[model samples]
Target: MLCFRFCPVPRLELVLLCLVLGAARSCALELNLTNSEKATCLYAKWQMNFTIHYETTNKTYKTATISDHDNVTYNGSICDDDHNVSKIAVQFGSGFSWIVNFTKQEPNYFIDSISFSYNTEDNITFPGAKDKGIVTVHYSEKVSIPLNDIFRCSSLLTYEENHVVQHYWDVLVQAFVQNGTVSRKEFLCTKDKGSTTVAPIIHTTVPSPTTTPTPKEKPQVGNYSVSNGNTTCLLATMGLQLNITQDKIASVININPNSTGFTGSCQPQTAQLRLNSSIIKYLDFVFAVKNENRFYLKEVNASIYLANGSVFSIANNNLSYWDAPLGSSYMCNKEQTLSVSGTFQINTFNLKVQPFNVTEGKYSTAQECSLDDDTILIPIIVGAGLSGLIIVIVIAYLIGRRKSYAGYQTL
Candidate 1:
């Protein structure tokens, strides 16, 4: 007896092959261009109407408008054969529509070309017909006309009805202008094809005016200075002086007169506004250093000491504002002094002061000295106790010796 055998193909492989074939078959629509014969007049004015049709079986749709460049449209129709159609309508999202109108004229001696552009609208459907509840569909197309091709054939003037056509026209116009082939002139004199008249001259007459000279405003005076010790000082408004002292080696003082009060003990090299006090109404103290007696005051070196017993130093690399460096340093016992000097309003002076240092050794010596005194008193107390104990032992020994002598006598 003979047996028969059968084999089945996988469903997934078959579906994939079908999908690839469908994708390969799907291609963009090709645009058709109409050619025209050359004419002797070089330029002829003619009115033409063009219609663009958008069709889709999708029912959830609305009407929209077209692009505004080159072509005028109304109700989905552009210029009529006699240029009677004043507008054209275009559609957008969910079938929205729009219309616009404009006119163009060409010189009789030169060949003229025309083109149109349109705006595209995408249609999307949600809660799809099948198990999947959403679907997106995109529809985008454009039409363009090259300057050389435009002039070559009058029939080829119409461009594709798409959104990007105007951009293409803009590029074409720029290229034409740059290549010196075309020049755009404003038709100011010719409102219509009519008679000519003499151009009018516009003139302005000046009346004899009274002269009340106003004095120029003087420059507001202000002065600001930051020291190497990170101290900041500001003098503003009728001798209003403010001084900021560093409490610690790394203490940065900011004096902002415009603000409520001073801000201090900030990190060095921090790009924070320390002192904002201005000598004048508008002049405020900015972090900057000045030079005097060949000394450079750098602003970036401004720093302050932290209360946590840690030294905070400011980076002094950037010196755009001032020549002096403002920063802080940590020291054991040595007084941390910040020396700040600058010339403000032709007055030069240097300010110096010690900042607060919270290091461990700051009060250690005094504390150690106090502890040593306590130890010295303890030694004296111990010596007195030992003497009292020796006195007691001597008394006891004397009593025992007396008792022994008495016993010997009794014997």
Candidate 2:
């Protein structure tokens, strides 16, 4: 079973071997300089799109184009276990050089610090040509940008060659450098590039409530009247007529004599009445004598005199002979006066009486009356003898009473 002896590799040799492997894995690569010549042999442009981040700044997305160049190189590599990179250098052919530092290393990509240098061409000298500057591409995890902020980028170079002419090459490099940032200030892209629209705001206002007044009656018109006694009796009447074509008699009063003589041997017979001028249109007065107590129902003779000087008489001796009569008298002995008055109607009339015979055992007396001044007034009169008797009685009473008191003795 035995006879197997194992020899350990030397530390130095193992180290060397590891270094060789690492170097092999980290070997810098150069892209074929003439790979794009089949498409266009003339000087052409190139663009790079990338995203980056820095510990002190925010994430950024950028696009850059190289407009002018004769040659360029793109070089990058991952760091090794020792944080050392074998391709941590950039070579601008024809003796130009730059130092590079790998800041990040991932499974498929890396970010690096860049240094710059210049190389001279044999016969061509680009005016103001010092050296193209180095641009650092920091690594980032994000692929998008904010709407209001800006994304910035440094200039970068890409290289190509002409296969048709050996040793002829071209470099695409940015002609102008933008040292600052670019803003994401554009309106959002839409499916239809030709159309754009904005929404409108709707506003409304409320209204207040309002108030709304109420609607008065008319008066009625009527009539009134009064009367007091025979002889000096007074009467007044009042009324309202809306549409009166002819005259309206609102009140009337009359008196007549019975067939029993109105006079006796000792006194003269008399009767009196008054009426309202305000309510009556026409009025007349007359008197007569009849044989019965129901004289007003018996036949009689009479004459009527109106305030207008109109004379009306009834000689038939019939009780109804008088145009209008007081309650129970058969004869209209005298014509009486009637007065009518109001805002719309006014009138007046008179009455007179004559006694033909007298009997001695009876005496006749006269009455006195007053009327409403506001409405109307009417007065009736007998012979002047009765009036004279009234005055004589008043005077004699005063004089005899004075004389008797003066002669009287006090106890």
Candidate 3:
């Protein structure tokens, strides 16, 4: 009851792709570039601490910092290899970038120091600032990155008003075929470790037991969020098998639950329920009811195959949530958007899977449904009417007899 909700090829897909490409090619993940080591769990959460020091040429400056930590959920690391990471890089937009340089020691990666920077003439603006000024930022932070299974990628992490609430997990692919590969392309190396070529490596803050307090103000943390135009809280596609044409199969779903990026408990969302089977042809329906955060498809059209390969399509009868009496409506509010991609569902049979995002106008042959409530309702109404009439006639006859008997008693 708690797992069915999900979306389409929107910005979410693009973001995942970017994460894949950037993670595969990012310089900060030196292990990814190392040929001897294999990189797995490339797509996982990285707990980042960002400190932005914005300074101008004329000596005007301010610093702001933010921690990706939310007290409850722990964002994990990058590798499964027992060998610790020697380098960690967190790249910001076009300008700002951060890296923690470390050396690969006997068993663990020894962190030497953390480095980060942002430099721009006029782009870095704070809470209150005049129009034009050059700004330079040197931010340093330490964080942990978690590891994920080979097929799964923790694509998005959302918090409501900066509070970490659970039950909003939406992992994109539960199983991956690894359609792409990561390879180390090129390298620029220096013979001497201390040569001027490694010039950028500099001394950052190495906190000792006792250090004098500095009066510098803490940097302001900025807002970070991920959402679509409709503000879907969380979505995932689970147990989905695709690209089967010859055999009967199970189906796919697109659950677009509505929320401002916050999902918890039973909040049902709009969905495209589809089930495709070689024996059952195809089935598709689009719905936009209220949003619920629980997982599992409330109702799906299914097909039952007999011993002799005979098949029957499931309709209103098999559905617990979608069960409506014969001729009665679906009893749930439908989605208003006429979007072609707004809804989807699946089926069970000899294994075939297909998708239809086109607008559904009327029920086709595959959508033919049946319910026995009306078949029994007609007989019940007639029997009830006849029973009521018979009782009324018997009461009238008894009254007439009483009137007739009153005259005899008077005589």
Candidate 4:
């Protein structure tokens, strides 16, 4: 009896200990890159300081920097030849993610871009920014690394701004690289060095532009998927542009699946893709099975947060957009828009959607949207007419050439 009582207590303590350890685990900034042959190409150790300059309600500028050691967790990493790009991502704070992309250029691979996205409803806040949703900043120039040498650029800072807030990156990067067999050599970017080392490469800080910066454009199209355990359930590729109205003012938002947070339920006959925005409070897109073998977008739900801390809710459940048969996808390459309400609208461009019944983690077939059929048919008819005319002209030219050859007794 004593063994039974004490054994349960120890098992409970073990379970609680595991939970504590799991919660205490944090992410490291170390990353690796490999080529298509499964050979190591690059090794990087990096940490970043993101500082945001925002104007408070009293018209005073204030700055905040993200703490790297506090609440940062590594999301995932990918290196593929499909785009010749390598990526590693981390989620910090509540709803903020930072992704770094690297690209190969002949004998060297360099940092291609860096993207930072944050939800307004989360920990990070841009006080005076006119634009909302996921805010992304891209580096126009490359940060390169040489072969067999470690590129250390600890002094280079990048500055960018949107309509309201200014953003800055103070990144410390040390990457070892090579052309064939990857190796590491110490090369510094700092001005102070000992007598034994070679001359260091210097980098200047990027200056702020003089002109007023336009709002950053969000990604409108991407291929996105979701899985349960080891099985794939949802696969879709679509372009999404949203128009939202508040207080008679309209704002356009671009939806990039990579930067947006995704959560949904996938059942046998029903599936959903809920995209929650850090800028917007809550957003949802619903797709359901209909007509036995067909599925269509059935609803849209959103709760827009206002400036005064109030919520504005909008939804439309009577939508039947983008209907396609099971095991196939619906495609429309033309531009189209669907009106959900007086205050909400969704626009699509070069669209392709498959929300249910995917097999082998891929779309099995395609069913073009009816609205796009007429647009495609007109181009096909015009091309056929032009081809027929060209054929007639070619035949006439051939006959003329034969007659001339016969008259001259030429073979």
TM-score per prediction, in order, is 0.15, 0.15, 0.21, 0.42
Candidate 3 lDDT over residue span 59-105, tens digit each: 33343333221112111212322343434444445344445443334
Residue 149 deviation, candidate 3, in Å?
17
What are the lDDT scores of the predictions, listed in order? 0.25, 0.23, 0.28, 0.56
**For model 1, where is the 10-residue window of minimal lDDT?**
11-20
Question: Mind giving the per-residue lDDT tens digits that candidate 2 earns over 1-411?
Answer: 112112222210000011111211111122211111121111112222111111111211111111122123334322232342322333433334444343223321222343333332311322232333333332222213232222222111211111000010111211111122222332221211222322111001011122100000111111111112223222212121211111221212121111001211111122222211211221222233344221121222333222111223333322232222223212222322221212111111121122222123121232212221222222223446678889999999999998888888542
Which portions of model 3 show Cα errors greater than 4 Å?
A: 1-44, 51-85, 122-411
Model 3 residue 23 CA deviation in Å: 26
Q: Candidate 1's error at 310, in angstroms?
A: 53
Q: Highest TM-score, which number? A: 4
- Model 2 alpha-carbon drift over 4 Å, by segment: 1-79, 84-86, 104-110, 120-123, 126-411
Error of 4 at 344 (Å): 0.3
Between candidates 1 and 2, which one is better according to lDDT?
1
Question: Which ranges in model 1 have alpha carbons more than 4 Å from their true place?
Answer: 1-74, 83-86, 98-100, 104-411
Candidate 4: list runs displaced more than 4 Å: 1-218, 306-310, 374-411
RMSD of 3: 24.9
Worst 10 residues of 4 by lDDT: 10-19
